[model samples]
Target: MDWIAEMTDEDTALWRSDLGLIADAARQAGDVALGYFNQSPEVWWKNEGRSPVSAADFAANQKLESILRAARPDYGWLSEETDDDGDRLSRETLFIIDPIDGTRAFLAGQDLWCVSVAVVRHGRPVAGVLYAPALEEFYEAVEGGVALKNGRPITVSTTPLDAPGRFAIAEDVLKAFPEALKHRIERVRHVPSLAYRIAMVADGQIDGTFVKHNSHDWDLAAADLILERAGGRLVDLQGEAPLYNRIQVSHGELCAATAPRLADLLRGIGERRGS
Candidate 1:
């Protein structure tokens, strides 16, 4: 115990207990977005064909920021809708948020979008929540705790690695799968929200999913923790886990699957990447 005297990390239990606040904030954000969803909120493009943002996204972002920041003033903030502050890098804990993930889907009146949020300390997520208002699914997870969906516990699909499994994947990512494995894997219809797609994997609704390059921490953090607690993981194609709240928020190619199938999925992805 004498080797490390200066470590002053917050108790994990404290973080777990605060999931209620994150859940409430996320739900409130979702409510703000629902007011605009399908009713057609003003939309605009960002990154020149790479992404879109809506008025709903901004409204929800403001609501979430006001709620979460006021509750925990010490936490840093990273959000898809907010401009980078750079000050978050020095804080011990931070809020990673996606006011409305799947803004494209929401603009198109699809119900797959969500409000995603997570608390990360020292580069690892300590607590997380994903709330999909239309779907009415609220996922929660904390370090060393079971994942939950709508207040009921959930876990990843137990489908064997070599057996037929449903993969919620993108068209490009699907092309990367080995032909043989592709035959056995059923490609699930495209899911627009990165956070919702990952939650499907956590609740065993889908066996796995792939993330395209250039995803950000806000898009992945909350769901990553849920999937992790559900006995699943989201890792780079090379099988390395990601660290959050970094100076560079963009992430590389990634895949998520239950633990029993992580290796198999990664191997197939690596093969395709090499080819």
Candidate 2:
């Protein structure tokens, strides 16, 4: 299937309005996060130590939920900090949200955290915004317009697969790649927020990155649209883009990169998967 489709003029205007609404709400959510950034907030763990949540997260989540739901009460809601309702799967459109995508980084006083929100219709993201107040960066996209970072357009890198490049990858995933591909990988680090990592790829701050198994829809939704609009693509290892707000919001191995490099990474890994 095509990554994005041609939108009619009417649809374009509608998506643009959605983008504007989400951006304002996201910025407000970011402000709520700022109130708790770098200060100790009640911290807790989730998924048996696989993840974290803090008071800042809930504050931001409540702010976003109140704003967005007031504006679009009919839209479904799926958020990292909220309990999911089976009702979201039935809506034609919904908001997928993560009030604080990089809680660990935020807790560590790093500037990598962000507020991510997206509008998905028919399983595809039509509008999205990623606002990182700590980093002073805001990335946004609508179906018919170019992606932007703080009012400036953004795009992915063209760094070749054979060229040295920085990547965000799990140690185990990197080790699984063949040595030839491994040699091309450079400046690797673990990023706490999957959304921020994808945003970095869209803005060309890094070459590319990989997602491990079981990343949720809230983690990937907004940034996925930004990367795609910025001339990059985030997709499953099988070369298909993600569909958000499914009956199950979980996803398997995913990758994000400029189009050509994405194909290159997949081919390298697919061949090895068979060996």
Candidate 3:
């Protein structure tokens, strides 16, 4: 059964309440991170120095964990800053969190970072929020509700599928496209936060983006729901949406765009692979 279709009135009401909870939690986490942003809040290397973590990330994570866990003790927790205890796998619902989505950007004083939080039920997100304190942009969505940005509904760009459009994708990936198609895509400057990049697509700031492989649930759960409610999608090469809070949290190469645009983008990618 489709989980969303199976949601009863009580389920919907509960998810909406969870949305409010996460929205406030995200804002609080963002505020904590912002306090150390650009102040060089002591950096540390993780994943063998391939990724950077800051004191700000931990502070924000602490704030989110404290606020969210206390509010919903039964909900499981998965966060980028916390070591996975594997306990969340048994829970029916859990909080997927990225306390600081763009730690590198935050350290550099860039405003593209955000605090991302989502409530996942039965492997899908029910409520999600992305709060960029530096940018002052708050995005949120819940199951059976419209996407919102600071109280206003938001949607993906209405750009025609065949027309030239902007994308947040790496130049190398763009080069894989047919020359004609490559020229039609205007690559935007890199936005350090993967979650914020997807949020841009949801808000119509960009048409789409290509997310490289190895993106984790915390990096995507919140933004995925926001983008979906905004009339777009974030799907893997197979055109399948992600399932969250699984034993394995990482994902493969993915694409995000409005339905029609995503079809075209995926076609181009398939062509690149076929050749």
Candidate 4:
């Protein structure tokens, strides 16, 4: 059954309400982050110095947590800037958020960062929003609805797999592609925000991207629904969609593209791995 078919009228209304809630909360968090954007908001290293978290991240996370949790006291919460207390796994629906995606880019005075928020039901997202204050772009999607950017509908690129296409992927990952495959694709510059990169694919600005291993739920949950609603797929190598609010919040190598293109990309990756 389709996602909407599985939901009752009350469930659909609730998701739509949740969509509005997150969209507003995301924008508020974006504003909080923007206040620190280029001001060099006190940086701290986490994940053993491999990742940077700034005051802006904390500030925005606080804003999102306060607004979202207060509004939906019954919903569980999980965020990049907050400690995961294992509470979300108990709730049938929960909030997954990244206060400021692309902290490095934000610190570098780049406009690629955003506030990402989603409402996940059971194990999949039912509503999602990505708000880029610097770019003045707001992308939102709810199950059974079209993906929207600034209120306009968006869709993934329809480029055939055989045609040359554009992608935002790491150089090392691209190098592993067979020469024939490499020649048929254009490697776009790296985007620091994985969420924004996937949204680009959703809006047809890029054909697809590869998500490296260790990406957490907050990085993908919001954009996953946006891309899916835009008629694209974000799946792991096994062709399985991600399940959120689980004990393990991390994901392995994944790809995002339109269905047919995703299949071709997966096949190419598999062939390269087998060689």
Candidate 5:
């Protein structure tokens, strides 16, 4: 439960190595996605059209799962491309992956898509990596450790959340709120990928994100851990820590910020949303 004592120097080194290997696997997965990008092999929906998943996602998942399992067979696997395999619960460490985080963007030939990877232990993320192959940017973090982009250390900007800082949010964020707050914050940018949006916050490209419900553990786990390591935080609008790998994988509305200003944003958002 404690991060300071758990993340020793030795632990950091080992996580760093694992992150590099996972990044390589992610890059390979991105290469698989590239083959079908814009070519549109097939597009379909599961359940209620929550989101679109393509053949490329499965292909990239296969490539990534193959590489990771080959290297570390004992680690459990959890991925968006495959059906939920309950067997992962028996292992102490699990690999949570999103092969193509921004499938919509990728299918549209946008370069904002990415491959996200994370190692979780006892319901907490210990290491995380995100690779945007088209953009050639790699981001990673070890728990209680540094966040890096392309092997260079990165930190979130200490910008005030109430100020005119950039905000990245899902398309439905405003729709879920009352007219008062919905019309109050007009500078919101909608991004297709959760991990990419979190990365933007870690690198100070964006100030914050207001995420409505319905994101899964695999979608935000890696990015959440990375943002914390980069001097930022992702918490529920009610000011509680975000949990992972629960029976209900769906997450609640969240507010992410580089500084403690998340409290201010979340308070206002909560009132508007009647949460």
Candidate 6:
């Protein structure tokens, strides 16, 4: 009874303790990814040509699931590296993850991919971690707590959205909106991993990121929570907060930014999409 009482608390220490456990699991998964890096491991495609999963992804996912489930057997698991299961719906706390967020970048030696993990309570990510082994960076956040990178506190940039600032976007996003190319983005860099891009936004490495439709829940869960915790914003260009655990995992056209004009940018994109 004392152990059960200790696990339940209204204090910050309780949340941190649980988050610390989750962070440890994420770091372990990152190590699994590091082992496969630059070693020419086997790779394969899934869901036609859109999503790719590798042996590295599976390896890391296995480690993550094992560690987390062993710690909290009651929590449900949702992951990009695993098949969808409706059973997760019955659980209150769910583990959402992307074993290798930027598989393409990982395979190509780009070092932008990360292992993303989150503990979603009810419908929101209350705690999360993003571990980029290649960059030696670890970003994490607990509910109502500050965001951090590698144990040091991090904050988002306060620059206005219209100001010249770096932006991470998908390569195909250009084809979707050619006019975006003229929108005064300070720099448009393509990163293969959505979670890392979100982490970069949180860490102030970039001012913003624009993601198109079809990104899955695992891709954005951890980073989404991280950016929010860092005092930034993320939502569909349509102006809706992203949701998870739906039958359709694909999220449509999300834009994340630390700028005050974050809403304006979303409004502008909405107007363009309507026109």
Can you give the TM-score per candidate against the true fold?
Answer: 0.93, 0.95, 0.98, 0.97, 0.89, 0.89
Q: What residue pairs clash in candidate 3, if any at all? A: none
The 10 consecutive residues of candidate 1 with the worst lDDT sum are 1-10
lDDT of 6 by residue, 1-275 (tens): 23323444574575677689889998989998999999999988887877677899999999998898898898888998888789888887788988999899999988888999988766667788999999999999987788999898888887765566677765555345436543655556677788888888898888888887788888888888889889887888656678777667788778998756576566556655774
**lDDT digits (tens) for residues 1-275 of candidate 5:** 77646667887776777777787898899888888877976878876996788899989999999999898898888888878867888887789999999988988889898999998877888889998888989888887679999999888876654455567765566566556545444455578888999898899888778877888888898898889988889988667768776667789778888665576567667776567
| Candidate 4 lDDT by residue in tens digits, 1-275 | 26646788898899999999899899888998999988988999999999999999999999999999999999999999999897788998899999999999998999999999999988899999999999999999999899999999999998877788898989999999988778877999999999999999999999999999999999999999999999999999988998899999999999999888788788889888983
lDDT of 2 at 10: 84
Instruction: Report residue 221 deviation for candidate 2 (angstroms).
Output: 0.6
TM-score of 5: 0.89
- What lDDT tens digits, residue by residue, belong to model 1 across residues 1-275? 22123333456557865687898999999999999988878888898867888899999999999999999998999999899988999998899999999988898888999999999878878799999999888999987689999889999999877788898877776776789767767888999899999999999999988788999999999999999999899999667789898889999989899876777777776677783
User: Mind sharing the TM-score for model 4?
Assistant: 0.97
Query: How well does candidate 2 score on lDDT at residue 39?
Result: 85
Find the candidate with the highest lDDT and give its number. 4
lDDT of 2 by residue, 1-275 (tens): 25346557887888899999999999999999999997899999998998889999999999999999999999999999999889998898999999999898999999889999999998989999999998899999988689999999998987766687788888888888888788877756777888999999999989899888898999999999999899999988888998888888899999998887787789878867973
Scored by lDDT, model 6 comes in at 0.81
Question: lDDT for every model?
Answer: 0.87, 0.90, 0.92, 0.93, 0.81, 0.81
Candidate 2: C-alpha lDDT: 0.90
lDDT for residue 88 in candidate 3, whole number 0-100: 99
What does the lDDT read for residue 248 in candidate 6? 76
Best candidate, TM-score-wise? 3
Clashing pairs in 2: none
